[model samples]
Target: MSFRTGKDFEFDPINGTNIIAREIGFKQTTFYNSTLTGTHKIDALGGFTVNWYGSFGILDQYIPLLQRLQYNQYTNLPGSPYLALISNGLSQKSGSVFYSTLSDYLYNAGGDISKSFTLFGQNKR
Candidate 1:
């Protein structure tokens, strides 16, 4: 959800409001030494004002996996993750209005992983 308001104190008043709603669902099934996954996204925006801007978004994901046993057995697992973000901004003036505005954003990410494996003689009997 987001909202913004602005007005010319000498002449009149200006204001606005906005709201949003969303829902998502997912499911998966697997039988083997593999994995399956799915995702969903929803977003909405609406408002009324002078020199006003806003946005909202929602994201959801689901995953299911199955692994085989070394001898005789089975394993089942399921997982899900979700995220949401909202932002709003506005600028206005009155009585010979004169102004300037600016905005900026920055992001960075990094990761690393390592693994090792070993093998034995084949059918050394």
Candidate 2:
């Protein structure tokens, strides 16, 4: 299992704009294995095996509105005149969190036995 997170912050004194971002996530994995066998002269040979695995994780991002756009001579102006540019900037900051999980397992079992006897020439059972 593991956990991680990150954060960033910036300030523009001239434009009086501040940018902040943070992220956090975690991950976990599990595994299992087992085997069984029998040893006997008269008995058949038998064995079994199993394997299991699992994992999970999550991630998220956050951005302040002011940090979405580059504060400059053109972007600094607040009005519908730069609607396209401003909307683009907002889109950049718009982000969503994500999560994922996966789990699976495998199992196998088998057995075999052989015996030799004299019938006509040779026989096996």
Candidate 3:
């Protein structure tokens, strides 16, 4: 325990924390017939994803021997030690919290067409 003065020392000890999480997504496509004169081709893709996170924690110290310095009612009460700075119970309860989320999607489409023509000599196609 650490000392804060002639009449005060480290007493209240507590811990707090939080957490989070998420999800993923994917997509793909294919096609046939690659040429206008011979055949045609096409492809596409689409998908969506989701994710979220949340966390919380708290610490509380409740001891009858411990005292709060803010209250004068215990100052001149005889055996009641003079506490300089402290909490009475719920007033000293400490905690933390966090929350987050993510959701989105992507889509794409593509196609192709082609043809061959004869030029001058030797079967150029």
Candidate 4:
């Protein structure tokens, strides 16, 4: 059995814009994955052997937040501390927050049976 987890953050920004934008945005995400697998062999009649194998896995993705806010450039400039920090919290302005989650699972199973034989002093299966 094995397990793994990860977290990520992004500063996606339109470096330089002439006009038509007054919105601030940020994004964050998290994920986790796990797996389990096993195999077994059994003895059967007449020298025949049987093999069984199976595996299972799962993955989850969570986007905690994709926060966005549009503050007036006329009131607070881009470099101002008010714009840099949530100085006044949310207000009556163009604002949006988006989030999502996803899950995936999979499984595999198989079996095989075979016997050995001798022909003309050579081994055959």
Among the numbered candidates, top lDDT falls to: 4
Highest TM-score among the candidates is held by which one?
4
> What is the C-alpha lDDT profile of model 2 across 24-79, one tens digit per residue?
44545555656665544543334222333333333333322222222222325554
Query: What's model 4's lDDT at 88?
Result: 50
- Per-residue CA lDDT of model 3 for 71-101, tens digit only, reads 1223224556533333334542112122223
Compared with the true structure, all predictions reach lDDT values of 0.25, 0.38, 0.28, 0.46
lDDT of 4 by residue, 1-125 (tens): 11212211122233322222233333343444444445444455547666667666666667665554432222224553322223354542335455667777777777777787799999886
After superposition, candidate 2 runs with Cα above 4 Å error: 1-24, 43-96, 117-125
Which regions in candidate 4 have their CA more than 4 angstroms from the true location? 1-44, 67-98
Assess candidate 3 and give its lDDT: 0.28
Pairs that collide, model 2: none
Listed in order, each prediction's TM-score against the native is: 0.16, 0.31, 0.20, 0.43
Model 4 C-alpha RMSD to native = 11.0
lDDT of 1 at 6: 29
Model 1 lowest lDDT segment of ten:
68-77
Error of 4 at 91 (Å): 26
Candidate 1, after superposition: displacement of residue 125 in Å?
A: 31
Q: Give per-residue CA lDDT, model 1, range 1-125, as digits (tens).
A: 12222222232223211212232223343222222333322222322212222333233223332211111111121232211222232222111222223232323333332222245844221
Local error of candidate 3 at residue 47 (angstroms): 35
| Residue pairs with backbone overlap in model 1 | none
